[model samples]
Target: MISINNLTFEIGSRALYDEANWHIKPGDKVGLIGANGAGKSTLLRLIVGQYAPTSGTISMAKDLKIGYLNQDLLSYHSDKSILYVAMEAFERQNQLHAEIEDLLAKLETDYSDDILNKLSDRQLEFEALDGYNVEFKAHEILAGLGFSEEEQKRPLATFSGGWRMRVMLAKILLQTPDILLLDEPTNHMDLPSIKWLENYLQAFDGAIVIVSHDRYFLDRIIKKTVESRKGKLTLYAGNYSFYLEEKELRNELQANQFKNQQAKIKQEERLIERFRAKASKAKMAQSRIKALDRMERIEDVDDDNPTVNFSFKFSKPSGRHVVTLDHISKSYPNLEILKNTSAIIEKGDKIALIGANGKGKSTLLRIVAGADNQFEGKSEHGHNVSQTFFAQHQLEALHLENSILAELQAFAPKHTETELRSILGCFLFTGDDAFKKIKVLSGGEKSRVALAKALTADANFLALDEPTNHLDMQSVNILIQALQQFEGTFIVVSHDRYFLDHVANKIWYIEDKEIKEYPGTYQEYEEWASKRLVKTEVKPEKKVKEEPKVKKEKQAPSEDRTRLLSKKNKELSTLEKKIEEQEISVKDLEQKLADEAVYSDATKLQETTRAYNSAKAELTHYQEQWEQLAEEIMELEND
Candidate 1:
């Protein structure tokens, strides 16, 4: 378990965290979330000792181990195979294997009992460490992360940064440390790989702190949510969805209190102003003024979700058909991407191109955008169609020397500086942030600028590939709103299910080297696809006799059995009463803990938490006793 108490971390003049406290208990699954500049990732680094906090303590058990998977690991390169890299996590096992090999070689020449005994000991240690399964685990993890068996054998240096990051994640997962600190683990993952990871993490025994923008992924995995805001950390008792609802309620309460306090202040000010004009009431007015000064001022709640008011600009409308692909056949030396595949994109079509990695989603996007003409295909554009293709590579196309505002101005010459800055604000760049050079911006910031350029273009047909890569939840929501308001057509390739569900009206996927379309929203497509999979997977079962049934005479209870059943019923009744009392006690303690007044007081919160847990344990004990007695009674009555 890791405990972060009264933590204060500062960067230059800015305090990223001030008195932020979080306790990560054993088997705790937490989602760390905040705005773009809110310091979620920085806190993770502080915990792992990569960055030292300005003050306070982050203490963990002496024997505890941590495995961290971060974006910086993308730069890690090695000529060794990915399997070898992942197996490196088993340091002791690998050493024992090396020793065993050395001992075996010496024994071949010496044929000595000492060498034999050492070899036997090393082999036993290796077996005890489960060293033989290390390779299998590495392979399994690599495959789950979207690497093929052949790919696993390939050198780590051969893969791109994203794929390399997956290898690093595999290595961390293979370590099986006491805790995992994952920063944007789903960043480069495809849908299948993301789902596989979700399943894997669900079964992970250690604690996890995941910082991700994927709402669905957070909801599926984390049991607790922590928000970093204004140099303070706030804990939510539930997942992302629950946090959203709870946050809204808290905001409403705070807003109401603030409003009431402001009204009280205004009333007090008016009374003081009137009374100050009279010499007789001057003393009372002064006393009221002092009281008002001493009163605690309630801070108003800040708006977390900003509205999207910027509509995309388009010069002209396209014809009915936006894009048409005919008999497309694309192939590499060994892998066939598309074989005689065809698809059509019509006006106003919001298509989500999704599938497993290496399924030609990007390749198909390139073909559709007319960015790639090497393939054998008949690709045609509609009349008066203007197209803008947005991809990760476009980030490299940005001018590093230009300021954020200047970059947008260069892309959209028609827009004024104020208009460009306003556009930048929608992407989370505000005030002095827009003046920052593109070279200094983070990957997510660069992504926002690129997406801003793409949306600002005078194009009616857009081709977006992984547009939500580094965006936060709020930014993604802004993009969704912008896309929903736009009249243009687009085909986006993203693994974010939440973004897809909101923005896409149709789903496109590659299957059997051909383009397939489901003429429905992403949610509908998921339901249909899951039902199809079930239909294919399920087989009819033949009826079989379950077991021999008890005879009617045997089912009749004897006098001794009846007495036992009566005794069990009495015990079960008493247990039911005790269980009810304990349940009420637990609920009372829970309600007390839920109160802000109680929770804000450390001693009260601790006492209530302990009492709640004890009450819960007592209730569980009574329920178990009741179940056992009820089962025994059922058996006795049957006999």
Candidate 2:
């Protein structure tokens, strides 16, 4: 539905895209992938018309609706409830409904045929747009995005940035635009909500273009992958995993070709050098030199970034129990974030906290770390625990004016100038980079600095919240390696599935106002979660049967007709109840099949699908029995 012809976009002397041609057809779910600074978000803005290409034509069908969700958006503040904001997407439907109502009011008096015809047209348009279910649809969208009914009634200003983003997502989903351009849509989402979004997009009819770092989300939802590299776009069929394998193979081939070309060039140069010393072979040598000059040299691909390597060396070991929380409960006025929460962090334990955006995963982390104490709980740390807590808002707490080196020096007072500089260097702050003021650092740079500071402390236990937020893939791997090697206890709250899958030894799922521990990796947690959800949805089918006494009386009635009728009535009531239970079972199985997480698990998914089918078959059997019983009951009543 949208086409870009010979697109060229540049920022000052840098060219983001040069003569790039691309097209997005209807129902295309494309994942935009690129390295840091590859202009993925910039291209998204270009497609949405937020930024005009320096040169090229972007053509789309006239009047085609498009929705763009940018990373940076103004906080929506109004007295209107969240539901009202979501319902705003169907403004046309609302307007048509209002017009219909006005027309009906006018119909009470003498109205012209022309007015009546217009009213009829408006009514038809409203009905065609599903105007009657606008509110219901809006509510569904909100709930799918993880908003509770009470939250729906809350004002927009009462929510935090992450919650506000969910509201925006709800608006976009409810709008159902012809094309959706989303940038890091899962940035503020938890595992469960991310699952919801995946299902929503999988069933979405319109084309979708997303820029995200969440591999699991993309792998499950997107069918096509578009990668930006070296001022060009490469399209790959299939999901993120497919793209990864293809890209690796392609890069290896390119590297081999480059090496071969370099070897040939060197060989040619060596032959020319030897022949140049001989007067008789001077012409041949000159000819060879000209060939070397004219030959197009293959450019070598840039090497991957160096990994940030570090090891924690503690002076003394902490007690067996690093930290413990007892009956922790926190609430903010009307919102109860955490209640009766208890967890124990032992030395050498790596734990991952998982939940939806507003489920207070971070809050729980903070409470455990003793950073926030406005709660009714006893949080105790082991002797000489030496704890370090990394909050999501750590960057805001930094002294921006201090140089990176100075910041580290202030945190590690015992370290010499050289020691501090060496520590900063490990985090990519080299030479003058260490001297740069923190205020001028990029988001990624600031994140690195914060992480460096957190690690510099001789803390045996680290509590990090979204530490991988601004880091690139390379940096994330480096941090993962560092954390994996550390002997200290680690409790991190993050949404990056890959990171969690690689580093976490245990998964803590926070849901339904409680925390449940899963003693396995993220993949295992996913499997367990899928099975649990299916079991939760599978209901027992109810059975219906005719009363034995009524059945016997049908063959030999006459004087006992009233007794048979009473028995028949009782049997009918029992059959109705049984049918109702069977119906509930069928609905439960259907819900299980429709759940997103069930589809995410490859192994359990097949089992769940089979189970769902079996349940459906069982339901059908009960349905047939119910029908037969109904017929028999009807005959008895007529008699």
Best candidate per lDDT, number? Answer: 1
In candidate 2 the C-alpha lDDT for residue 596 amounts to: 87
lDDT of 1: 0.90
C-alpha lDDT score of every prediction, in listed order:
0.90, 0.82
Q: Which residue pairs collide in model 2, if any?
A: none
Write down the TM-score for model 2. Answer: 0.79
> Worst ten-residue run, lDDT, model 1?
539-548
Question: Superposing all C-alpha atoms, what RMSD in Å does each candidate have to the true structure?
Answer: 16.2, 15.2
Please name the candidate that would achieve the greatest TM-score relative to the true structure. Answer: 1
Q: With candidate 2 superimposed using the best TM-score fit, by how many Å does residue 5's alpha carbon deviate from the native? A: 4.1
TM-score of each: 0.83, 0.79
TM-score of 1: 0.83
lDDT of 1 at 522: 87
lDDT of 1 by residue, 1-639 (tens): 898999998899998899989888999999999998899989989988899989999999888999998988988879999899988999999999899989887887898888888888999899999999988998899999999988998999999888999999999999999999999999989999999999999999999999999999999999999999999889999999999999999999999999999999999999999999899999999999999999999999999898777877797999999999999999999999999988889999999999998999999999999999989979999898999999999999999999988888988998788778778888888889998999998898899999999988889999999999999999999899889988999999999999999999889999889898875688877876776577546523311242334354446667776787788778877887888888888888989999999999999999889888888888888876765565456445433
